[model samples]
Target: MSGVKMNNVIKQYGEIQVIHGIDLQIKDGEFCVFVGPSGCGKSTLLRMVAGLEETTSGQMTIGTRDVTTMDPSERGVAMVFQTYALYPHMTVKENMGFGLKMNGHPKSAIEAKVAEASGILKLDEYLDRKPAALSGGQRQRVSIGRAIVRGPEVFLFDEPLSNLDAELRVEMRVEIARLHKEIGATMIYVTHDQVEAMTLADKIVVLRLGRIEQVGSPLDLYRDPDNKFVAGFIGSPAMNFLDATSGEDGVTIQALKMTAPNPIGKTSKAVTAGLRPEHLEIDPAGDALRVDLVETLGGVSFAYLVSDTGEKIVIEERGDEPVSEGQRVGLKFDAKRLYLFDAETEQRLRA
Candidate 1:
């Protein structure tokens, strides 16, 4: 197993630079996830580490070796792509052993390695089945088994579950997490879904536009986001941001018609107040906002509310009180739970 390191890594195509200088560290045997919106260069960054994309500058190291310019095959890393990339006519066993066969390994060695990987992924029964005869999840498992046969020092997954349905995605997430633990190998996964990152990562790197916005554990980034972008990007319902102005009394929220703590200490400066859906409490006595929609998913529910200024907010409902669409309600929360960001810089106002 090996840790991966990037020192001021950069990538560009001609004159148009896509990935800015990025410095990251993925510790040995750690599950690190790179998450961001589309076109944010998460995939590009992963490819660079795989040696599929050229690094215009800076250094990349795997373990203690400088693999900055090494070929993908020589980097001691195995990649499982979004697409299954399975051979349509090959049996699962054959496909998983194909890489070793291509490398001129003995036939018996290939079969032994394939069997071991199949057992680990629980694909023993499907070993004789071709890609066409397998379900999406099974096919993906075979694809993963192919990587496992390589026994690479690091494993890389590039949105490997995007093709699966929601149920299969969840199932595969558990399988992948289990695979990481069973193998205890270094793994770097890339995804646009924050939910996957939250559930799978030991450490997460949040990217935006070609640069990293923040990097930390899932809960750290959720509870103590450094800026508005991170706060809005991490949570499922996302954080609600309302425009406001700082004053002597505090920060006055314009959309919700309320006041918040002024942690900025910059009076008269424009700011945005952030509140998470789960943290908000409904004040039925003060009808300042109107519920636009209600979504109940078994044990939890969410009330979508709209303010006079047309700003929307999602409030989580897990209590006994029932909130229906079109009902009028008010929002309240503790001052300590509120997050304030400078409107101009979009940075958190640390007190």
Candidate 2:
């Protein structure tokens, strides 16, 4: 295992710069994931680390080696791409051991390495099968096994499970987490899927439009988001945003009244209020809303509603009685659960 360091990394294409200055330190054996929307320069940064793309200006070091200008093969890294790039005609074992053979390892050493990787991946039963005959999940494992045989210092995965079905994706996600634990290798993954980043990462690096937003553990980011974007992007069903304004001694939502923690200053203006769906309760003593749709998912129910001011919100309610559409209901948000942010900067306000 090895640590990765990026010092003032920057990337550009001609005169148009895509990635701004970025500095990060990924510890040895840590599973770090970069997550963001499309065109956020996440993949571009990952490529720079893997030596697949050159850094326009910065220093990249792996372990104790300065590999900023090293070739991809000499960077001591292996990358597993979104598309399972397997040879159509090669058997699983052949594909896994191909890198060793090309590097002039003896036949016995190559065979031993392939056997070991196949065992770890549980591909022993399907080693004779070609890519066409294997399932999508199996093919992805073969891709990972190929990277493992090289014994790279770092492992890079770029949306490795996006092509799988929902259930298969979940299964493969668990498999990847287990593999990381078993191998104890430094791995960096990039994905747009928040679920993948939340479940598989020890630390998540949130990026937006060529610059990093924040870096922290999944739960830390969830419990205390630095801004509205991080809060909305990290959670499922997304956090609800409501326009709020501060009065002489309190804060008020559209048509729904709320109290502030303290007196609001003119400069400490409130613009947006955020709350997660799970924090809302259908209490009789709360603000009233009209239900638009209720989606029952067996274990829990999601109530989609519209406030009197026309703002949409979702509340999680696990109950026996089903809520129907167009039904008027009251909602109580846990006061301690609310988040306030600046409307212009989208930055979170201190509680």
Candidate 3:
């Protein structure tokens, strides 16, 4: 396995800079995922690591070798693109062995490598099938199998499952995770999907506006986000943000108020109170809200309501007790799960 390093990397087109100076270290055999919205520079960063795009400045290394200027094929890295990229006339075996053949590897060596990768990916049954005859998941596996045959030190996946159906995507996700465990190759994946990043990564790299926002384990970022953006971006259904003003013991959120143990310092006069939907509970005898909508999802249900001050709040509830629209109800935010951030800077203010 090999690790990857990017030091003070920059990317620019003409005079406009897309990627600011960024530094990252992906450990050997670690499943590192780069996640962010479009125009966030995640793909550009990955392309730089693969040598598909030249870095405007700075150094990049794979393992102990400086590969900033090395050709993609010479860097000992393999990339699986989103589009499958398989030849229409080629069989699965041909597609998987094409790279090795081009590199002058002997026919016997190429055959052995292709057979091994096919077995690992369970593509042995489909080796004779063309791309047109395979399912989306099978096609994606072929794409990955092509990479596997290269015996690369590192694997780069560029949203390989984006085109699959929801169920197939979930299945492929598990397959990829298992492949990582079995091969133990260092992997870097890029995706805009939060759930994908949260589930697949040993470490998640969150980027925003051409710069990295934060990097940490999934739960670390979830449990303790450094800023409002990280807090809101990492969770499903997202954490709700309510405008608030800090007072003696706690902050006031319009008519609905909650108290914290310690007050935010004078440096932060105003704060935004954030509550995950799952952290907000419907309390029959608590703060009143007019239910606007309720969405049931088997084990959990989300109730959307308008607070007494007309601000929107989303609450998670359990059981079969149904909530109706336009019904006035009470809700409470779990104090322990609350997040407070500076209103101006959007940085986390208190624990």
- Overall lDDT per candidate, in order of appearance: 0.93, 0.89, 0.88
Q: What would the TM-score be for candidate 2 when compared with the true structure?
A: 0.96
Residue ranges of candidate 3 with Cα displaced over 4 Å: 255-268
Query: For model 3, how does the per-residue alpha-carbon lDDT over 85-150 read when each residue is reduced to its tens digit?
Result: 999899999999999999899999999999999999999999998999999999999999999999
- On the 0 to 100 scale, the lDDT of residue 267 in model 2 is 51
**Candidate 1 — which residues are off by over 4 angstroms?**
263-266
1-351, model 1: which lDDT tens digit per residue? 999999999999999999999999999999999999999999999999999999999999999999999999999999999999999989999999999999999999898999899998999999888999999999999999999999899999999999999999999999999999999999999999999999999999999988999999999999999999999999989999988888778889887788877665666778889999999989988688999999888789999999999999999999666698899988888878889898989999877
Task: For candidate 2, give the lDDT.
Answer: 0.89
- Candidate 2 error regions (>4 Å): 255-257, 260-268, 284-287
Worst 10 residues of 3 by lDDT: 259-268
Instruction: Compute each candidate's TM-score over C-alphas.
Output: 0.97, 0.96, 0.96
For candidate 3, the TM-score is: 0.96
Pairs that collide, model 3? none
lDDT of 2 by residue, 37-139 (tens): 9999999999999999998998999999999999999999999999999999899999999999999999999889889888888999999999999999999
